[model samples]
Target: MSAQPAETASGFATEGFDPATATIVAVTYNRSHLLAGLLESIVRMDPKPGHVVVIDNASSDDTTQVVESFRDRLGAELVYRRLQENTGGSGGFSEGMRVAYELGSTWMWLMDDDVEVLPDGLARMGAWAPRFKSIQGRRYDYDGSEFYWQYRVSVPLGIPIPFAPAGFDDAGYRPMNSGCFEGMFIHRDVVRRIGLPDPRFFIYWDDTIYGWLASRVTRSAIVNEFVLKRTREIRQWDMGTRHLNASSNMYRYHIMRNRGIMAHYYRAHGAYRPVYFAIGTAATFVKEIIRLVFVERTVRGTSNLWRGLRDGARIRRDPSFRVMPPLEEAPS
Candidate 1:
């Protein structure tokens, strides 16, 4: 949150690569082409994963076709589970984690659909995870190549921090913004306690909320370059546009509604203020305006965000605008 130097993202592999790792679990609703590239890298891991699971969240495209193309090459080594409904990213990720749980993997690597694991992801993250355990409360470069620490409010480089640690190192461990997700290889035992990410967060911030919780139960903060993520991607697009286009309905519905929901906890009890949340709550409205007037000239998506905010202000239970299980593990 403080003014820090621009992050060094390019050299993460060499300066921070870790090569010893195990199974990885990823989710993809579509874009099997992109996923195939990631899966290919996983197979080449040094200590190959005992299992790799991909939960297809009802993708309309030839996603299954894409995955199947690689079946013979990866064998049962890669397991694919096609879903019946599109519950959203939270659901998709939860389903993948559930599969990882069933496999009894010591660790589960979490990856996004549009992201690619660095060539040395497994070995790098695996190696750093332990070395990280030694330092405790600190983050290492993806391949154990570099370490980044929070100086005042900004994170800067220290030395090369190993990706993983063999034993617990309570030195400077901090849970990630979203605890462990976004290409995180989680420990099995931790799952039994924490369960999967909160299913309520349908569109965004599920990770941030999860990190707050994880901080209470474990030390999980980290900065790794084990994977290269397309940080920005469209969940949907209107007739035409380069920017992500959301349904006028969902924008009004989930994105807007979830703002108040997240603020209730994140701001009130989770350390946020209503005023700040209000300012943030307005961002969606602003973006929608820009899209309508400048970027895409679309009124539908922006309108939906308004409707979502209206509904969100009424929410008191879980802030996210979603209908999911109260808090339960996905079926195995």
Candidate 2:
């Protein structure tokens, strides 16, 4: 789809983009304290989001109460949905996007409860709406340093380009094929074309595939503008330029298991590389082993890698493991 320029009454030109047409979709699970901070940040936005959709993944805590407290303070409409069970970040985002789309939102700003949006973040992202449909804003690490996020995807290998440039170009933005859910600002039309994030991923790599799909249909890029700050801090291995955070056993399992699902996406997009993917998968297993032995100082979770590999192989062969199509195609 092509973007058309139009000027608003205030003389600001856009591709029919308006902040009032955007909806914030946040997925929270047992993090009321963090969720409250995120909501507070949204309330302070210069042009506050037109709507807020919070998907509570069956948290036993007071997540519902915290959301209600902001109803009066926030000027926008708030919709809260609590699931009966935890559906992981992927499922929550999928549900939240579905809800926001059903509400007729033109734009969806997706994020997690552990991060707080900057007051001018949405405005900076909106400036590029006249040019691109799938956009990602910058983020701050827990230590207040700039996060390393700019990179394109190696579809054949199903991994991000490790040696990609670190910063944006002279245009203040860089084209990207991978997507990060932390601060993804996308138009509804892109969602209509790419469909919701795959829930089967459960966690890891779902955003990358979604972003790749969006890039196939529109101009997808990540801008050099700080949009949010990560509130949660975890022990990380300093890799000179970047830091590799510690991962839980569950994360390790899903991260490996999801590679099988990723292969399915690669083949669907006509970029399948069996030998390269297998080599990459083996390298990942070795890396995880090193992290567990050196960084984590434990080998208790080593079985997760093998189990994940087994499950992934099964999923890759299953005919039912398919990409979800757009519910409604964009108007031609």
lDDT (tens digit, per residue) of candidate 1 on 219-255: 5645333344333343433322123343345434666
Candidate 1 regions off by >4 Å?
1-21, 131-176, 179-181, 224-226, 229-253, 263-276, 283-300, 317-332
Q: Give one digit per residue, the lDDT tens place, for model 2 in 56-106.
A: 999999999999999988778999999999999999999999999999998
Query: Candidate 1's error at 115, in angstroms?
Result: 2.0
Quick one: best TM-score, which candidate? Answer: 2
Task: Estimate TM-scores for all models.
Answer: 0.64, 0.93
As for candidate 2, its clashing pairs are none
Q: How does residue 79 of candidate 2 score in lDDT? A: 95
